[model samples]
Target: MDELSDADLERYARHVILDEIGEEGQIALLEAKVCVVGAGGLGSPVLLYLAAAGVGTIGLVDFDRVDRTNLQRQIAHTDAAAGTPKAESAAARARAINPAIRIEPHDVKLTPETVERVLTPYDLVVDGTDNFTIRLLLNDACYLMKKPLVSASVVRFEGQLSTYRAFEEGPCYRCLFDAEPTEGLVPRCDTAGILGPVAGVMGTLQATEVLKQITGLGSGMVGKLMLFDALDYSMQIIRTRKNPDCPLCGATPAITRVGG
Candidate 1:
C-alpha cells in the first residue's frame, strides 16, 4: 500500500473525508493503473476525473484529431488544441489537472494485432470508443486477459453503460452483442447527432464506475445495463446475465487469440 503524501492528502481532501473513500481508498486511487481508450466525448469526463482523483497512471489511446466542432462536449480539448491528436490533447489536459500522475498517450489506431500489446499494461480498460470493431476486439482481448472493462456509449439524447467482466460473475460484451453490428446500421455521434450534455452525463457515470472498481467501494454494473434518456430525464437499469453460449466467453470458446 502506498502512503499518501501531504500533497496527496491535501489534493484529495474530499475523498479522504468520505467514509467510503478514506485515506486507504485515496491511496488505492493513486496506485491504480487505468487506460481510457478514446479521447472524444465520453473520454472527456472519464479522463478528467480519473486524473483529478489521483489515479497514478493513465493511458490514453486515440487516433483522431481534435476539431473545433468537438469543443461542444469534448471538454478536454481547447480551441488552441484544434488539429492536435485527441490523445495528445487529452493528455495535456489531464497533466494540467494533476501533474503528479503519469499519462501515456498512444496516438495510434487500435488494431487486433496491436490491441493486446497496448492494453496489457493497464489494470482496467475504459471503452469510450464509438467504433464497433474496436469494441468487439477489446471485449475479446479483455475477456481473454481476465481484466475488467468499464464501457459506456451515447448517441442522440440517450446513453447506456455497463461493466463487463466475464472472468467474474458478469457477462462479457459478447453476451449482449454477440456480433458486431453491420456497418452503416448503427449510427455514431457524428451522424446521429448527440445532445452535448448527454456525453457529460454518461461520461461522469462512466468515471464513477471506474472509481468504484478501483476502490472496491460498491457493487458494480457488471451484469446490469443502465439506460439514460435525456428527453424526459428518465433512467432505467436492465439486468443481464452471462451467456454460456457466448462465443467469446462461452463454454466452448471460438476466439483463441486477441485477433483470431
Candidate 2:
C-alpha cells in the first residue's frame, strides 16, 4: 500500500474523483500485480484498461504472432505489429498507454509444466485464452497458489465471465467444468465466426471484475456466472456453487499438482 504521488493523482484524476475509487483505491491499483494470459481478442481490452488504470505491474503471456485476422478484435495490435509476437505487441501498447507501469512479456506458451512458474508471481490472473486445456490449467494453478482468477470466453455470439477463488469457499473453474471437453467439442472463435464486439464486451467485463477485485469497491463475480448473448443483446447472471464432487476444490481434493 503506497501513497499516491503527484503524477498519479494527475494521471488518474477521474478514478481518484470517484467515491468508490478515491485516493486509497488508486493507491491499491498502483500496488497491484496482475497477469493476463493471451493477447488476442479478450486480452486486448484487459491489458489496455488495466494499464490505463495505473496497475503497477502486468505480466503478459502469449506465444502467438499477430496476423491480419487478429486486427479485427485484437485492438492492442496494429498493422505495423502484424507478424510480431502477441505478448511483445501487447506490452508495447501497455507501455505506450502508461509509461509509469511495468509490463513483463512472456513470449512462451503456458504448459502444465510451466504454469506455476509463470503465474505464481502475480497477485491476480486474468484468463483470456481460447483453449479449454489452458483454462483448466490456469484454474488449478490459481487455486493452488491462492490467487484470484478472472476468466472470460467468447465464441460466435455468446460469451461468459466468472471469477474463481477456490482457496476460499467459492467454486473453482473445475467445479463448473469438471474436466476438459473433448477435442473439437468446443468451437474456436475463428472457426465459429465471432463478432468482434462480443469479445470486447467480455474482455471489458473481465477488466471490470479485475478492478473490483483489486479495489474491493463492490461485490465480485465469485460464485456467479455472467452470460451474454450478443445476438439478442441480453445478459444474465446465474449463481454457481462449489461442487463437492469437484476434483480440484472439493472435500476430497485430488488435483494435488498442476498436471495431476
Candidate 3:
C-alpha cells in the first residue's frame, strides 16, 4: 500500500472524508497508473479530474496541436497554447492540477505500430480519441492486452459511455460495432458542430467511472452502456452482451494481433 503524506491528507480531504474512498482508496489512487489516448475535448475533463483526484501516473497520447477551435471544448488548453501539441498542453494542465503526480506526454499519433507499446504500461486506459480507426485499434489492443477500457464518444448533443472488461467474459467495444465505418460516413464534431458542455459532461462522467474502476468503490459499467442526451436532459443505461462472433474477443478470435 502507498502512504499518503501530510500534504496528501490535506489536499484530498474531501475524498478522505468519504467512507467509500477513505485513506486506503486515496492511497490506491496515488499508486494507480492511467493512460488517456486523446487530449482533445473528451480527454480534457478526464485528465483534469483524474489529476485533481491524485492519480499517481497519467500517460497522454496525442499528436495534434491545440487549435483555436479546441478552446471551446478542450478546457485543458488555452489561447496561448493554440500552437502547442495537445499532449504537451494537457500534460501541463495535469501537472498544474496535481504536481505530485507523474504525467507522461506522448506527443505522437496512435498508430498500429505503436498501439501496444503505448498502452502496455498502464493499469487502465480511457478512450478519448475521435476517429474510428484509432478507436477500433484501441478496442482490439485493449482486448488482446487484457486492459480495462473506459470508452466514450460525443457528437452534437449525444454522448455514450461504457466500460469494458472484455478479457474477463464481458463485452468489448467490438461487440457494439463490429467494424469501423467507412471514412466520411459519419460526420465529426469538426463538421457537425458539438455543444461544448456535452463533451465536458461525458468526459467528467468518464473520469468518475475511472475512479470507480480503480478503487472498486461501486458497480461499474462493465456490461452496460450509458447514453446522455444533453439536448433533452435525459440519460439511459443499456445493457450489453459479448458477441461470440466478435473479431477481437469472440470464441475464435480472428484478430490475434494489432493490425492483423
Q: 1-260, model 2: which lDDT tens digit per residue?
A: 55788889999999999999999999999899999999999999999999999989999999999999879999999899999999999999999999999999999999988998998789999999998889998998999889999999999999999999989868999889876678878889878878998999999999999999999978999999999998788999999999998898988988888888
**lDDT, candidate 1, 1-260, per-residue tens:** 65788988899999999999999999889889998999989999999999999999999999999998778999999999999899999999999999999999999889988898999899999999998889999899998898899999999999999999888778999899876678889989889988998999999999999999999988989999999999999999999998899888889988878988
The sequence of per-residue lDDT tens digits that candidate 3 reaches over residues 1-260 is 65779999999999999999999999999999999999989999999999999999999999999999778999999899999899999999899889988999998777889988988889999999899888888988888888899999999999999999999867989888876688888878999989999999999999999999999998999999999999788999999999999888888898999889
Q: Can you tell me which runs of candidate 1 are displaced by over 4 Å?
A: none
Candidate 1 global CA lDDT score: 0.93
Runs of candidate 2 exceeding 4 Å displacement: none
Candidate 2, which ten residues in sequence have the lowest lDDT sum? 177-186
Provide the lowest-lDDT 10-residue window in model 1. Answer: 176-185
What pairs collide in candidate 2? none
Error of 2 at 74 (Å): 0.6
What value does the lDDT take at residue 159 in candidate 3?
95
